[model samples]
Target chain A: EPEVTQTPSHQVTQMGQEVILRCVPISNHLYFYWYRQILGQKVEFLVSFYNNEISEKSEIFDDQFSVERPDGSNFTLKIRSTKLEDSAMYFCASRGPTEIHYEQYFGPGTRLTVT
Target chain B: SQQGEEDPQALSIQEGENATMNCSYKTSINNLQWYRQNSGRGLVHLILIRSNEREKHSGRLRVTLDTSKKSSSLLITASRAADTASYFCATYVMGFQKLVFGTGTRLLVSP
Candidate 1:
């Protein structure tokens, strides 16, 4: 089965530095999303994208965060400045067309570690 | 205490036994979904129960939704050791495009 895939399975960056987490969602899916999980915490929604534009975002997705679909298959989340609290597992997910929008396929996730 | 919360943060069972986890939400939802995640791995979609549906089954997994009570349950019958993982219930809240995940219930099935 086709699955969402993310690059840089593990990323380590210095505090105040920038980092980009990339994902290639399942082809043919129309909606894409980004979520993050702090160690031992619930998975929190960051943002959703459709038609190459942001559909919705959470408070945690402040100015520091931005998402881009620079190409047909690549969806990326960029954090301008990282903080210690920013360290977490960032997951990328995609949902099928309208008929199957309820089910989302998730990628293996990129573990971001900011020191 | 949040939008989505699951009871019994951890559960232990033996092979061939059954496991059930309950999840509660605070708001109306378009649909509720169950997902499983092995340690350090990606989430695997299990089942999704729509707001209008009372119950749904896929293989050994069963999911029930009670929109009136804002609660849902996931049951794995005759579970195997491979069934051990953290189970999470996520809600696609009404009028929202994103999914809100609940604190997961970790299951450990010994062979």
Candidate 2:
């Protein structure tokens, strides 16, 4: 079965540096999303994208965060500046074209560690 | 006590036993989904139950949704040690495009 795949399984960066987490969602899926989970915390939604634009975002997805579909298959999340609290497992997910009652397939996730 | 919360945060059982996890949500949802995550790894989709449906089953996994009560349960029967993982319930709320995830239940199935 086709699955969502992410690059740089583990990333380490300085507190003030920028980092880009990349994902290649299933080729035919229509909706893409980004979520994060702090160690021992529930998965939190960051942003959702569709039709080449952001559909919705959470408070945590402030100015520092941006997502883009730079290419047909690549969906990336860029953090302008990383904070210690930003360290977490970032996951990318994609859902099929069906309008409703579809499950989102998740990638293995990129573990971001900011020091 | 957030949008989605799972009860009995941790559960332990032996192989061949059954495991049940429950989830409660605060708002009206379009659908409820169950996912599993191994230690420090990615999440794997398990099953999905729509708000309009009362129950769904896939393999040995069974899920039931009670829209009126805003609750859902996931049951894994005749489980194996490989079933040991953290299980989470995610809700796609009405009018929202994002999925809200629960705190998750860590299941440890010993051999």
What TM-score would chain B receive for each of the candidates shown?
Answer: 0.98, 0.98
TM-score of chain A of each: 0.97, 0.98
Worst 10 residues of 1 chain A by lDDT: A95-104
lDDT, candidate 2, A18-110, per-residue tens? 999999999999999999999999999999999999999999999999999999999999999999999999999999776663789999999
- List ranges where model 1 is wrong by over 4 Å: none
DockQ (0 to 1) for model 2 = 0.93
For residues A30-88, could you state the per-residue lDDT of candidate 1 as single tens digits?
Answer: 99999999988889999999998999999999999999999999999999999999999
CA RMSD, predictions in order: 0.8, 0.8
Off by over 4 Å in 2: none
For this target, which candidate reaches the highest lDDT against the unseen true structure? 2
Q: Show the lowest summed lDDT stretch of 10 residues, model 2 chain A.
A: A96-105
lDDT of each: 0.94, 0.95
Error of 1 at B99 (Å): 0.5
